[model samples]
Target: MAQNQFSLFKQKFFSSFFITQALGALNDNIFKSALLIFIAFRAGDELGLNSDLLNNIAAGLFIIPFFLFSATAGQIAEKYEKSALIRKIKVLEIVIMALAVLGFFLNNIWFLLGILFLMGFQSSLFGPIKYSILPQHLSDKELLGGNGLVEMGTFLSIIIGTVIGGVLIGFDELGVRILSVLLLVVSACGYLASRRIPETPSAQPYLKINWNPITETWRTFQYARANRVVFLSILGISWFWFYGAVFLTQIPNFTKVSLNGNENVATMILATFSVGIGVGSALCEFLSGRKVELGLVPFGAIGMTWFALDIYFANPTSSYIGELGPSAFLSQDGAVRTLLNCAFVGIFGGFYIVPLYALVQERCDKSHLSRVIAGNNILNAFFMVIAAALAAVCLGNGMTIPQFFMLTAILNAVVAIYIFSLIPEFLMRFLIWILINTIYRVKKTGLENVPEEGACVVVCNHVSYVDALIIGGTVRRPIRFVMYHKIFKVPVLSFIFRTAKAIPIAGHKEDPELLNEAMYSIAEALDQGEVVCIFPEGKLTSDGDMNEFKSGIERIIEKTPVPVVPMALQGLWHSLFSRKKVNKFIDRLKRLRTKVTLVVAEPISPDEANREHLYTVVKELRDDKP
Candidate 1:
């Protein structure tokens, strides 16, 4: 496995695909930005039209294609090879740019706006294939990193392309000529890059095409909703886009009216926000240990809310005679704080989005992934439209941009709490993430031994009260642990345990009914192809020593008849949650940041998973470490 996301750049396949997609994003933004800028500045005089009305029309035109053609695009992507499809899309971009050159030369706003609609049409077609192809080429471990790089490249391209477009359009006829040439060249380069993407076979080649947008769109949504987690993840991703659109659309005006800043200051703030998103997106691979870590989603949400609120509070009162330039803006009181707020909000937005994208890819059925992504695109566009309307309503009603920012932040908090409440897994993973990251540096080995799918009973030597948590956090898959009822009821930890759906048990003499129910639950979980981990010792070790494995493991394996994997937890005995005696305050200090290791051994066949054999295997794996 590649140790870091950067290593992926060294591979030709990933690099080619990344560049192709990034350039595509760049070209789309460049064209759209140039047209928007022209509409804002020169179009009203040249075309004798209302600029605001024209701007809204342009925005509406661009978004309409996503709604009209996304379902058809999804079906087409599923039925054909992705690489060829990408090259064709790039060719279409070249044709669109050629027409755009004519539109610019003639100074015809209607013609250019028509070209803008075509750009959106092209993008809607490419959307499904863009994400679906990643899974075809990348491994499960590379998925998160690949997504992070793509997101970083995309946002950076948006910033760079938008800036370049604005700057190029500012010059006279010469600027129009230069912009036209740049558009064609970028489109050609994107085509060249697409040529190098390794061929990916169709996912559902035999499927019939659905041409009707209305019915097909409904079917696409049903595909997305087929998996409950994936559906919610789509909603989460769309919500982020909604949140992001609101912030991005208001930045220029906010800088002008609220910050008393010139165009240069606005550009500077926009660059900071985009760069923050890039940095945060790149950091996801590192923070997640190259897996799709859902914990980062909640973490990202909290940061977005906090920083957005700060932006509201960071609004400065100092009045300038004229709009300040970039340097002057920076010198103004509360400027840096506002910039920091923008950057952190962007960073958390990255964290909020990347994992959800990965999860959608990882969980959605391969055959329907393209369609599901198409469904996501439709929702994303819809949400962005709503965002625009909301922003207009709020700003039109005399709400200060800062107050609007505050309102957005508060809405974000409410939405996040509601989503996490609906899917407690995100919150549960967050708590587990906090515990392991803060108090322990976990080193996991032989995790590949755990089966990627299907039922398996994992038996670990229980050392401390937090062994299950450590194991739960480290493993890539969700696990239902059979734990002691007493430990399950621990004050702070109880919430996490119950949310995790941990099975609680007691001895026959202690509580026979509860023990039988626990056993039945474990068996049923395995029957449903879930992973169930149990401490075969039946409880935490009291003296930092291995206890004899109980016959419960045998009984469960006999009932389920599944593979049994033995695991060991080492170096957690002295941790704060352990039963180890701490005689002094200094001893407590030593427990912080303890180095912990979780070792997973190969699965033992059902026939060989007896009490004695499994105990010896777990002991050997622990290497006598407490």
Candidate 2:
């Protein structure tokens, strides 16, 4: 698996993708950091402007574009092939880099500031395409791995960019020119990489275009609104950015005043955090079993909150300003602990975010993927602005750094509770998962008979609504169910199913496109080593017996040469939600009190998996109640 990850990076297309993304991130941070630093020092009388006002203006310049341009960018992505669009965006980056160079050389703070805003604009346009394209070029299973690599590349690039920007500005004569040239080169390289990207056609090729920023932005929100789970995940994602931006903006001051460290020491602390995010991002692939597993999102958030609070408690009370060298940092126990705390937050941040991002990618409508991403970016920018405003108010009102940290930590709990309440699936999945983990001792036999990893078509009888949940709860790996469209839309169940990336399938007469998409998605999932579950009976048995199997499973097997896992749910069909008659009012009487059993038989090979043969095998297993 590790070798596969490394090999992915070595692939020409993936390598190009990595370089373009990483360098774009690097350039963004380099100029933004340098411009911010320069303005902080010279915004006042040195440039005949109010220092604080100019600094605030600079912040707005960068963020405002996300609100203004992301929608249009998303439209362009959906209207055109992504590879070609990316190539054009890279060219735009090169222009922006040149303007950045010009701004720096002239020491025209106003012009340089304009360039920063343009960089933000450029990034806004790129944001939608960035996420939407992953579902296109990569196989379904590679989504997590692909997302991890992109995130790692992005953050590592950011660390290097900021550090390089900070260091380069210290030079007397040629620093600005050198930085500009470097950014231009990087942008050009990104263009080269983008050119290598394969073609990805638009999902909404004939959809009417909307170019007005504000109107389109509102429309994007509406599009997101139509997909409730996607919308909430967007909010969750936005909230995460808010949380991160606040901490990031404080690093310089936190390092100096709180940690009593020099700039270099502060940089190292920042590096630790960046490296942690990269490590955590990579870890998501393995933890999620290469599927877009949202179970890990809550897991990640828990770590982020815990570690962030620990950092506040971990702060040293006394100053160590004079003792600011690398050697001093290494020697000081407090500094070591502080650095570790910073790294912990970053690592957990990776855990918290990567899955959410992958979930958004895998579950969103392919055509509207970019638009949804744009809405997400807009909300992200809005939340970040709020975070900045809140931080400013808190700091201005005489809150100490540690106190602010503590408050943010506490607020995280409140925010989490609110979001989880609004969408209970996170909590619900965790509950059932915990129940399975605690109440039942699950054992897998012939696990090796099932392909260890890669996409497989899991054929089973539709025993109950909780069949998917039960399989998800007990399977050692994540599974994507190709379920009847309406069942997937059930109120509470819909949220959980979407979060789990279950593909909603309709019959030919109902929604042919969706049906085709589901079929293709199955192949895509298997191609990615994802576990795709499909009930051969298509729906729950109306009678208390399994129906004849459908041919869809057979077709899927023929298309994808991967193994097929034949399984049975022994006792769950007897539960209330199944075909068995129940006193509806009384059923609620014993909801949690009832116990259920789920059993998995060994996987059968594609050649051995004919409908009659596998149907008999599963029927025999289902009949064996124990």
lDDT of 1: 0.91
Per-residue CA lDDT of model 1 for 144-233, tens digit only, reads 999999999999999999999999999978899899999999999999998998889999999999789999999888877778899999
What TM-score, computed on C-alpha atoms, does each candidate reach? 0.96, 0.75
The local distance difference test score of model 2 is 0.79
* Cα lDDT, model 2, residue 532: 89
Top TM-score hit: 1
